[model samples]
Target chain A: MTIIPFPARSPRRYGDLVVTQPMALEDEADDVRSLAERLVAGEEAALEAVYDRWSPLVHTYALRALADPHDAEDVTQQVFVAAWRSRHTLTPSPSALPAWLIGIARHKVADVRAARARDADRLAAVVSLPGAHELHQSADEDVAEQLVVRQAVDEMPDPRRTILFLAFWEEHSHAEIAERVGLPLGTVKSHLRRGLITLHRQLEGVRHESR
Target chain B: MSHAEPDQLAGLALDPDDASEAVREHAQTCPECAALVAAFTGTRRRAGADALVAPPAHVRDRVLADVRAPAPPTAPPPVVVRERRGVPAWLAAVAAALALVAGIGLGRIGTGETPAPEASDPTPVETDDGGEVVAATALTALDSDAERGEASVTDRDDVITLRVRARDLGDEDGFHEVWLINVDGKRMVGVGILADGDDGEFKVPRHLIDDGYRIVDISVEPDDGDPTHSGVSLARGELA
Candidate 1:
């Protein structure tokens, strides 16, 4: 089992704790991008390769975002379709492949949300599922607690939040993040620096507020 | 690369001996710098925790299904031609004379009274119709008047085939060709040329398809070969 740590990169005055290295999940982003390019090229093998690589993650995200197994499955399918159709524009730069995919997933989630909006009762039913929002929030919390410093992260603007997610969630290097997000490396670093400061303040604020 | 360059020290761990003279002195007394050093020491820990969750299985099938769909038929009916098998000797001679006269008469248009050669030839070029037919079978049905079209998940294996057809591609020499797109219509890759009355086969890389994909399309192209497919879709289809 993976061990998630408490988010304190540098605690001022507490019992010292040794930090462990982060986990390496998979090289899914590049794999997905290459497969997407091939699939767009009309190569049958590309599709199969992509399916094998990221289906699990896609399904998980779909389930979490849509809160319906059937809808999750449908969204997963649509994500690939959107990826295939948009392959030409898919330059696997800063975001890498997985980040790009998550972006696609975000859009698909919005679409599912919009479609569900038409039916207030259905929307309410979806919202009423057992710990639905809590589940979603918890999963993110789990990831944050395990890998990223979430409370600090929650303080940034959308661009910074998005960029950081692409960097951390997708494990893209600074250069990779800059390229994928279409920003200069310097700009990316500045964002990171500012974001880190903001996150620190936010975390401290939460502690203060709670106290 | 084992040691972090000074410039790379934004958030990475730092080796003690490599610490600057001032930082080393600070570590000996000042608790703050010492703590920073310790924090830097364990920077690698962050790398392990940042992975996203995995997607489920069915997404894979849907993506591959869409990627393997074939190009749609977009051409007009084939032109008909008269048979030229057997004839009587006199009739043959008369036909030859008429042909000579027609040829001579047409020559006048080209400075020597020579008739211009007939532009349309009724011969069909050899193509992989079997593969194309299989591809067509995978698509949603086509309307009788549709000129350009696509088929989804027609056939698959390591390679997927898409069959594309066009009635009369006007000045298609430099046109942007065929492309396969993901569902969002943002990610895309070029497949091949959109030749008139011919099928275009796209080779999807096995890795990409394994994850998933959705739409396939063919378009009339101008010779200015940018990899971007002009949205002028001659044909399109969704994978089942």
Candidate 2:
């Protein structure tokens, strides 16, 4: 007689899945909500666990948005602390935790902007791509187009462009993007608008010349 | 060139498919809209690529560690442990022998019965990192009401007490302790151990109050008697 052996159950009973219950990416929203509750209750380990899972993404979003390594580091730390402090308001929902983090970073970016005025001018110098003067100097009209485009992107205000990057590249939803950048939901949409429009205007001469 | 409105262009910037249909249809009939759409689409495509950056791991760790540190516990005490008594003579003798076997065990456990250390006042330690000495400032604490929820502090002439509500402590070894460090940079001492709970109190050292020190550092420490900072700071306070 042939006998079928039942799979052994995991000692931790999280749910029906006997072995380690793996959270699909889709389930991350729920996971984050639960983690938030634990964090609100002063569970340091829970906060640490949440941080380990999501900080990399937050760091990357901040690094790209703020466009400075040091600023990104500061912003990432601020984002986690802010999340912990405000965790009590977290409502369990379908939105992923990363989205919430992105929101927190948004406000943090604004705080950084308000705190560091000197850094903005410094960032403008480095972040601004070669401009019309450089194009005129190089005397390579073909190269000038690319330079012009870069200059246009660089001209975008700190963090508006950063917000765009987080939304467009990171694929964060509007609410997520809004929270991370510290803009009102409507304002976030406007920045995306203004940024895209400004870039188009800057690149118009290049596009016309190229065609 | 007459192209899409900036707001419409904004929508197109996000959803290229929608732009492809709406703007292209308009562009086919109108030359100006076509130029505007191309310019907008090209620019949007270009700017989207520069949005990626990765931070170093060590930097990430440092910032995150600072953030994860808990706010200082306030309110009433939550934990209490009295010396367990009524053990038989043989067992008590065995315990005493075991303490002797482990050289520092008895003194540490005996002291454990007393209140843990009080909070550390911020001493101006010239902390040098990478050859640059930074005026290391450790403030006793700031407790935003929203951050602390229901925690509060009770202060008398010599003893400082704190009450706190804590969560998620299952099968965890050791209690949280309160520590006091001198602001004058002369002393850093542990005044008493604090129990974790929704309503518990910690008794601080009177001498620490006598000295001009008024900062509190609370940490979750293991029962092990190692006198080193575990780097796990939870809550903090300062003398007003």
Candidate 3:
């Protein structure tokens, strides 16, 4: 099992960390912008691609907020439905996509909770289950950022994803991961590096977008 | 081509000391690689802490099913979700500017005569929505309704000058250049640079506007000398 502790990025000491290489950033940014444009143009494939990529993260948020599987499922469905209709308004940015979807999911979850409040006093149950702030922090921006990064890690393609799980979740070294996954030492290092780039790119984009 | 590959950069992210001297030196000087390493390093330790719980597979089917059927009237109407979840001030500025531009476009139609194009009148054009208009417009900052400049097409004695003026642009460490982007968003033609903030005049094949190159744009291009649009718009407006 991975360490449950949350770790923050160490402070940057040198170089212009804010100014990204435009060439590569634009390449990744273009893919995001084009997907957004296509979705706006009502291309159905874009919708499916968006769903497949982000549904797990959306579902996780719904589940955590509502704590009831049925309500979570409904909210997940409503968020995507709302996304399709309001697709025109989505900002054409990469990190904005997931963050946008999460915003919708938040709305749908609130609606479910509101409906529950109307029916009865579920306050006692909510208060007793974990800490009150934990439940309340479901809507917190920090939590959303965590889920966004977690989703990025989870969604990475295999070998990279598998390698990272071993590296981070299991605290395995490069050789350990290679031995366990039955790959050469060099191949494991390659996947590790690739995974690092993907995760960092996503993290930076989301942070920039959020800020 | 001198820049490092994404993979090499990623390797340097974890610990710069572990890297070879050449790679470390390269990353220290390259802002792009530095920015990338900065991005990669954050959230790395905490990212894998939480395992994802996959939702039931049927959820996808249900979402697709809802897409097929229109929402029932009882359901709350979907709100256009523009809550600015992750959009920065710069992008939001563009959104607001676009809205004001839309308002201005409508106003032009109301005050002008029949926008129909005369066969010889420099090819007046119509929008996709079928309203016609001349080829002059105020270029507004993409962030606000403030008019940063003006652009117009003038044909004097058969010389076509796409005269454009803009001011107070972003200081993006690049020279400013002008372009005529098509309404279709696919085609574009580069005009000359703004060249000292004066009302710069440029010439293009007059037929290009007739071919739907009606949007005037000013963009900041890096000294990279790429001669490409860079997809970086400083100020823009459709030819009204």
**Highest DockQ among the candidates is held by which one?**
3
User: What DockQ results do all the predictions give, each relative to the true complex?
Assistant: 0.10, 0.11, 0.18
Model 1 chain B worst lDDT window (10 residues): B75-84
CA lDDT for candidate 2: 0.49
**Which stretches of candidate 1 lie above 4 Å from their native place?**
A1-40, A121-211, B1-56, B69-240
For residues B1-240, write the lDDT of model 2, one tens digit per residue: 356576675666565554447665666677666566666666655543442234566755665576544332321111111112243444334323322222321122111123322321233222122121111112222222112212223344423443333333233466665555343322346655654362344554444444533444455666565443333445443333
- Compose the digit string of candidate 1's lDDT tens values, residues B14-42: 23443456545545576654554454333
lDDT of candidate 2 over A1-211, digit per residue (tens): 1011111112233342222224322234336456665555545566677677667656765665556888888888778777766666555432335456655776676577556655567546533655733542333332333334444454467778677677655778878998988889878877877777766654553344233
Worst window of 10 by summed lDDT in candidate 2 chain A = A1-10
Candidate 3, residues B1-240, lDDT tens digits: the string is 377777777777755755777777888898887777676676566565466566788988988888767445433222221111233455444533443444334323212232333322234322333323346776766655666677766554444557776777867788888877554333567888988764686777767766666667788877764555554577877675
DockQ of 1: 0.10
Off by over 4 Å in 2: A1-30, A118-211, B1-54, B67-240
